[model samples]
Target: MEDGMGFWNLRNFNLAMLAKQGWRMIQGNDSLLYKCFKGRYFPRSSFLDAKESLGCSYVWRSLLAALPILRSGYCWRVGNGSSISVLGDKWIPNHPTNKVLHPINELADEMAVSELIDSKLHVWRSGTIMSLFHKEDADAITKIPLSRRVVPDSIS
Candidate 1:
């Protein structure tokens, strides 16, 4: 390769296609495939949380294998932040990890993004964010603009 980069080869291409399928399944919940997977594997949880189970279908296993790839590339567009976790979910847009990377200060990992959002105003609580995260993280958090219109958090 001119740049010393390796080719995508068959394995990489297969994984990429699988990851794309997983992405589609996440984004298009109305699809029958998504509905089937949800009912069988992740009935009470999100697709990202689904784990391998005994006697699972080959397709489900393949999709599960590609989840890590999907996660590394996906970012959640914060809405009300009700469904997103402050420390766990990937909500920060430009940050490398796409998550709150600073040490937690009196904040639980499972805390909802809504906790940092002013629901009435649909804006991030800057003071609260600053109080909780380090300067760099706080700045990153503030840079993620909020939409005044109400919408559910979606993958980007």
Candidate 2:
């Protein structure tokens, strides 16, 4: 029974190590896995799309095997709103649609949520919100708190 418990602990530890390494590879662009794929480690849309390729090293294959687990816990935490795309990013919460509620074609593809903020007052620009989003979307956007201090955007 003691031996069995020891084995179970070891198995859990191994799984945890693999998960950490997989997350590191996914987050670090300089990782060998990214280099192996010519700077593309995993798809941003979903890591489940990652697959074993011909002539790939054993380490790369191991990383690929752990992607599903990594993807399960992945989430976006909005910060300064500089890096997140208003139209393409999954920033809004509890909405049926992950993307922005309404997309304006005239807006640049790189338009960030920061653009909709009033820099002076540190709040959402009411005019911009009204112009870009519907009433419900504007309400949702307003509910999201913006940081007064500058910070980098991150994913977890």
Candidate 3:
């Protein structure tokens, strides 16, 4: 819908509005809308992972429809890292896609970032990082400093 002249597109605006609702569902766990949706739609998983069902309503379908737009920017801020998958979750910094550049190998897809961190010291295990991931990914992973205090994983 682009033209030589710079102007706002109503379609994009509408899409953005829909994506905002999806974002609110992610950030506002205490809201009634989120609570209702959680009970009916995504009881066991995150909003980003929610799936379509045969009997879902139009409004619910609309929110889920905007998920691709929401997921493109969604990323995990590492903490315990136990809940995040090394290859599946978006946690890496600097990469354009906000994902790890290296491809999964030998069940590495099932590995957690915690596996590359030393629990006692709360520091990244450099040797393990270098051994498991590509140089770029290893460097990016190391660049992200770990918290001294133990914290739960959260969305970023």
Candidate 4:
């Protein structure tokens, strides 16, 4: 692929493609919905509108909204108070903001991408870490792995 494509791009493109077919992601910032990912978990900052990005699981929340299922239905976001909620026919937090991560989330820090790379663990969740690419419009970039059946000629 080109030089850059992250999980976010993979997910956004996946969702957008699905939306075009009529399926959609869910609309709430429900912690339950987030629990679906293998290493996914709620970050402590979910309780606050924090500036720190790039690593927090909030990206997962954003990705969920970018999912084919949710994106076709409703957009997910934070609402009044400290609630993680959705805006639709009616506005509401899917659940109480007091929702905390399961104890497993604590143990998960070690499994983060940074920790894996630092530990010299060559295997990421599955693939090898090759490059980091950040782009303004992911769809405009055709080098993305998810975009092709075979790994891009450049990387392979």
Question: Which candidate gets the maximum TM-score versus the true structure?
Answer: 1
Model 3 sits at a Cα RMSD from the real structure of 2.5
TM-score of 2: 0.59
RMSD of each: 2.9, 5.6, 2.5, 20.9
lDDT of 3: 0.85
Model 4 segments more than 4 A misplaced: 1-13, 17-33, 36-52, 56-72, 75-156
Minimum summed lDDT over a 10-residue window in model 4 is located at: 147-156
lDDT for position 36 in model 3? 96
Cα deviation in Å at residue 127, candidate 4?
A: 60
User: For model 3, what is the alpha-carbon lDDT of residue 19?
Assistant: 98
- Judged by lDDT, which candidate is best? 1
**Higher TM-score: candidate 1 or 4?**
1
Candidate 3 per-residue C-alpha lDDT over 1-156 given as tens digits, one digit per residue, 9 for 90 to 100: 455687778777877899999999987799999999999999998899999999999999988878999898888888978878888889886776667887747646678878878999999999988877789888898998789999987777
Candidate order by lDDT, decreasing, is: 1, 3, 2, 4
Residue 147's lDDT within candidate 1 is: 93
The C-alpha TM-scores of every prediction are 0.90, 0.59, 0.86, 0.19
Off by over 4 Å in 2: 1-20, 24-56, 65-73
